[model samples]
Target: MRAAVLTRPGRFEIEERPIPAPGPGEALVRVARVGICGTDLHIFNGHYAAESLPMVPGHEFTGTITALGPGVAGLEVGRRAVVDMNIGCGRCFWCRRNEILNCPEMRQMGITMDGAFAEYMVVPARLVIPAPDDVPFEVLALTEPLACVVRAARKAQVTFGQSVLVIGAGPVGNLHVQLMRTIGAAPVIVTDLSPERVRMALDCGADVGVTDPGGLRQAVLEATDGRGADVVIESVGNRALYAAALGLMRKGGHLAAFGLTGPEDRLALPILDTILNENSVAGSVAGMGQDMHDALTLLVHGRLTTAPFTRAAFPLDEIQQAFDSINDRPGDLKTQIVLGEEDTR
Candidate 1:
């Protein structure tokens, strides 16, 4: 077996390693495709605080079960599956409250455990969701990220006919736009500095895509007949974008900050203004069980197409090239690594 091992913050090696076996309550999966997420880039650049060195950092992936541990019911070997990266102890207080993402002892795949950037990875059986037979392995790899989008949309309380604005045209941002539309919202307005992404967003159903704000507040107000967007989702983590998002939102609009902020990140906003406008800001992180399930259901039903989101693929041997391409290619959407020869075909 071969795996991409991160021995240090800025270094990774694709080395021959012994395949791991499934422990009790775990399942051994033959990794087919692994989506290289922004978190993986952060880990590669030493910017992710939660990831430790000498770890495998691939959370979004899909595979086939080669073996199942004892006592794992409702799951069978040979089933196609996608990984749910968030692994939490069921006994935790947060888990008890249906908020496993907030659990103190949460151990995410690729962060605390060997992730799917290998020939094989072991994960708790319950965390593996069955992938649709028609869904390509590469597309199935997006399940985890899609789950995150679903969670954020829920937190934002996106309603039918509500005008929404998503800041950022990257994979997550684009997904946000598409998902919001699925729930009966009006075509979303998307913003990003990359003109290529702006165009891409238009192809994917964004009503308006702009590099500048495009007088977004003014434009949206006119579209809504003097009312602004009902919900503003800040998928871009830049601190400056926070204030900009607030400015574009309606007086009583809900703002959901889905992107993670760095520890030292700070924002300067007038509290009184936010209060007077009846504006509320909420933050959402990784998905819970329901989010994961909903993501798979939508994907399987052909409502959430993952094809537009995937841009490139690389063999496992050229994992470094995969990372480099994702970093250098602005036009690329989802860059995935093919961990198995069969999957590449």
Candidate 2:
């Protein structure tokens, strides 16, 4: 087996290793496609807190089960599947409450543990969700990020005919726009610094797109009939964007922060305004078990299209180039690494 190991920050080496065997209640998957996420970039830059050294940093992936360990059930060999990255300790207080993301002993694949940046990886059977065979591997690889967006949307509690303002038109922002529409959010508005992404957001069902911060406020107000947005989702993890998102919401509107930021990152907001306006702020990270299931269902039903957001696929040998494409190309939405030559569709 061949694996790309990040021995340190800004360094990766392709090395050969013995194929791993599945342990009890685990499964060995032949990785097909892996989507590079922003967290992977942070890990590559040594900024993400949970990532350790000499790790394989790829959480969003799709593969075929090659071997099932003892005690595994409901999963068979040769089934196409996607693995949930967040693995919570069953004994944690949060896990007991079914809030896996809040578990202090949570271990995420590709961050704390070895991931699918290789030809094969071993994963717990319970964390593997069977993917529809009809969907392409590239699209199936995106279920992880889409699941995160699903969690964010649920946290927003968007109601019918309510207005939503997503502050960023990246892949996650576009997913938010589409999900908001599916959930009955009307006149979804997206704002991004890149005009190309703003256009992409519109293509993804956003009623309005704003490329400039100067126009974003006015656009939101006009779209909501001067009342401002009912929900504001901040998908860009920047301090300025966070502060601006706080201002884009209506009185008593909900604000969902879906982007990942550094542990020490801080935002200076008007505490008095938040109190007086009775605004609700919530932070949502990775998706839960149900979110993953819902996201995969949406994808299988053709409700969510990842084709427009997907870029070209790169072979595993060009892993460095894949990371570079994400850093250099702002317009590119999803960059996939193809581990096998078989047609994943």
Candidate 3:
């Protein structure tokens, strides 16, 4: 087996290693495609506090089940699948309540354990979900992030005809736009620093895409008929964006913060304004199994398409170049590493 190991900050080494055998209730997957995300960038830059060194830093991936360990059933070898990265302690209060994202003992696959930045990976059977045979593996790799967006949409309680303001027109932001549109959200406004990303957001079904924060308030007001947005989602993860998102909501509107900010990051809010307007702000992290299932369904049925977001594909040997492409191309949505030949249905 071949794997790319992040030995340290700003460094990666592709090395050969023995193929891992799946433990009980686990399955060994031959990774076909892995999508690099913002979290992967943070880990690569050594900014993620929870990520340890020498980790195989990739979570959003799709593969074929090469082998199943003892006790594994239902899923068979050669099946196309996507693996959920969140591993929560079954005994935790949150886990018992079926809210694994809030589990105190939650461990991420790429952060706390080895991940799919390799030709093969071993995943717990419970975390594996079957992928549709017709969907490309590159697009299927997006299921993990799509699941998170689904969770965010649910958290915001987005309703039909509601106006949504998504702060940041990145990959996640575009997904939010499409999801909101799918549910009849009107005037899905997306903002970004890059003009290309703003255009991409518009292409991804956002009704309004603005690059200038200076004109955002007016844009939202115009789109909502002088009222603020019904829901505001902050996907940029900057303190400034956080404060601005709070101000963009209508009275009694909901704000879903899905961005991953720095550990020491803090935002100054208008406390009295929030109290007076009855605005609600919620922080969402990762997704539940049901969310993943819904995301897969959406992809399988062509309700959600990642074609506009997928920029390029690279081989495993050019992994560093793949990481560089992300930083060098701000407009690029999802840069994937193609590890092997994908199943052609």
Candidate 4:
């Protein structure tokens, strides 16, 4: 099978190798489609943790199960599924509490392990969630990221009529906008450096989209009646934006920092302001299984769709170009790699 291998930072090599067999409690999946997300870019650029080279760098993916390993009772071959890349060690303090992202030995499929950037990839059977027959590949590929946004939304806890300010209009930001609207956030505002992204966010149900910092501040203040947004979500992974996020929120607002930043990143908090306003901030990582279920339920029922936002598609051979397209086309929402025929049950 052919796989795109990131042998080092800023490079890829498409090479042929023997197919890997699923170990005990695992499954072999024939790749269908893989979404190239911000994390994929981080992995490709070697900014991700520990910087392991010569690995497959795709986690947001959907595929058909080709085979199942021993003891894998609930899954079967020929089934369409989405793999939850977060593989916890199961016997840790974090995993025991169902907080797998904090497990010290956690190995993400695309981060620490080989992910779905190939014709075939082996995934733990327990991490696979069967996708519905009628769902399109595009939606299937988005299940993971949507699950991630679901986590962020839960952390932020924005309810009906509450003001929301999403500080990024990228793919993730658009997802946040749609989720916020679905949950009844009133006058949802999206801000970005790119005007196109801001427009895209507006199309995704954001009541206001601004491209400049001054405009964002004005929009937030106006939407919240001179106070601030009830909930502010930073999705752009910009330190400057994250630093300024607290100043854009209400006195008792919460900041859900959802973007991934450098490992050594630090924040300079306004100690007195935080104490005076009773403001809170929380760091949310990727979602767990239940979040994926909620995301899939939303997608299948047509409550939310990336169909309006997702536009770019590339074949595996053009993987390099696909990565380049993210930089080349900032206006597009999501870019995915089509491994073979776009198929369903």
For model 1, residues 33-95, the per-residue Cα lDDT tens digits are 888888888888887744477887788888898898878888878888887888888888888
RMSD of each: 1.8, 1.8, 1.7, 1.9
Q: Rate the local accuracy (lDDT) of all candidates.
A: 0.82, 0.85, 0.86, 0.85
Off by over 4 Å in 4: none
lDDT of 2 by residue, 87-141 (tens): 9987778877657878888888898888989999999899899987788788788
- After TM-score superposition, what is the CA distance of residue 187 in candidate 3 from its true location, in Å? 1.7
For candidate 1, the TM-score is 0.94
Per-residue lDDT of 24-114 in model 4, one digit per residue for the tens? 9999998899999887897887777336678988998988889998889998788888888899888888988768988998888878888
What are the models' TM-scores? 0.94, 0.94, 0.95, 0.94
Number of colliding residue pairs in model 3: 0
Best by lDDT: 3
At residue 13, what lDDT does model 1 achieve? Answer: 94
Stretches > 4 Å off in candidate 2:
49-51, 268-276
